[model samples]
Target: MISENKIYFYPIWLRIWHGINAMGILILIVTGINMQFSNPKFGLVNFELAVNLHNISGILVTINYLLFFFGNILTSNKRYYRLKRKGLFKRLQLQVDYYTSGMFKNQQPPFPLSEKRKFNPMQKVSYLTVMYLFVPGLVITGLALLFPETIIENVYSVSGIFLTAILHASLGFLVSIFLIIHLYVASIGKNPLNNFKSIINGYHDIHGH
Candidate 1:
């Protein structure tokens, strides 16, 4: 149950989308690592199974990403991710300082989470890059890999598959790094579990808000 002090931070669509997106990304990450390494002793699943799971999860995540994109637009929730043109660098610097220095001292964030601006400046930039740029790049490259004979051969004069594979693997590595940072920061809210709980239940306990 949500308490009076808590504010509704996530809507139903966002919650559902986020849940599916997170699960799909996790599955993709695990399967991707297994497929990339191909070490039988350390395999989470067989190589064939990993490939099938990765493809399925990637497709599902792409669909969910579209849902998130359209849902935010329809609901006007995309504003939360809009970066402020004015003082953007300053805000980003402050946020960086807070994370690197202040956070260790238990200092409050420079830009606290709120109903209006759910993300800080840094988050806005990072999330925007990830959602709009990185995700689309990954999806396109993944699709090319999926239909290599049809897409890759015609698209590139030579080494199309190799190039596509490099791009896909590079993006996957970047997404994994981003996920690690995201989970670490999510644990740094008012309480260790505050961010996780908010995502799960929609209610966020903003201290003194």
Candidate 2:
């Protein structure tokens, strides 16, 4: 059980950014589904309206991600990947093993969080790729779709808007899959509620448990 004396951890900016980004991604996914299927299942909206909203939300999500990125940099928070210690590979291996096998046996998590290092080995790799690589790639492709003509005129050999649209959708699908896995793992915490509470109330005190 979490001790009452455990302090709150997450800052206000992280909380706000997380909430907004979640909403924006949801909107983008829903609209994307309707646009892709082009069916009455979701009562397809006007094409122009859907595209406009997608563009705006895309911008918002990109900006929110940036806020999260710089927020971490400015703080004393050492990113997961920055954890400098011997047995880095061993720690990562144990983390992967726990996720794949130990978790099913109800084993306790191998890595705990602190002010400097808040993410586990898996989280470090996942978040690093998502933030530094996939997210920026998605944003660039989305902006290309939003303004195809402008992009085509400036860039010589870059694939056209059609390709950009396909790339963006592919990245979106990948991100959606990651979200499903993330949410499920989150539910596996001490009380299930503990994961949710930590994000909202901050600190997660797994003192005795």
Query: Number of the top candidate by TM-score?
Result: 1
> Clashing residue pairs, candidate 1?
none
Worst 10 residues of 1 by lDDT: 149-158
Q: Could you give the C-alpha RMSD of every candidate to the true structure, in order shown?
A: 2.3, 3.3
CA-lDDT, candidates in order = 0.84, 0.74
- Backbone clashes under 3 angstroms, per model: 0, 0
Off by over 4 Å in 2: 1-5, 40-48, 78-89, 153-159, 207-209
Error of 2 at 204 (Å): 1.9
Which candidate tops lDDT?
1
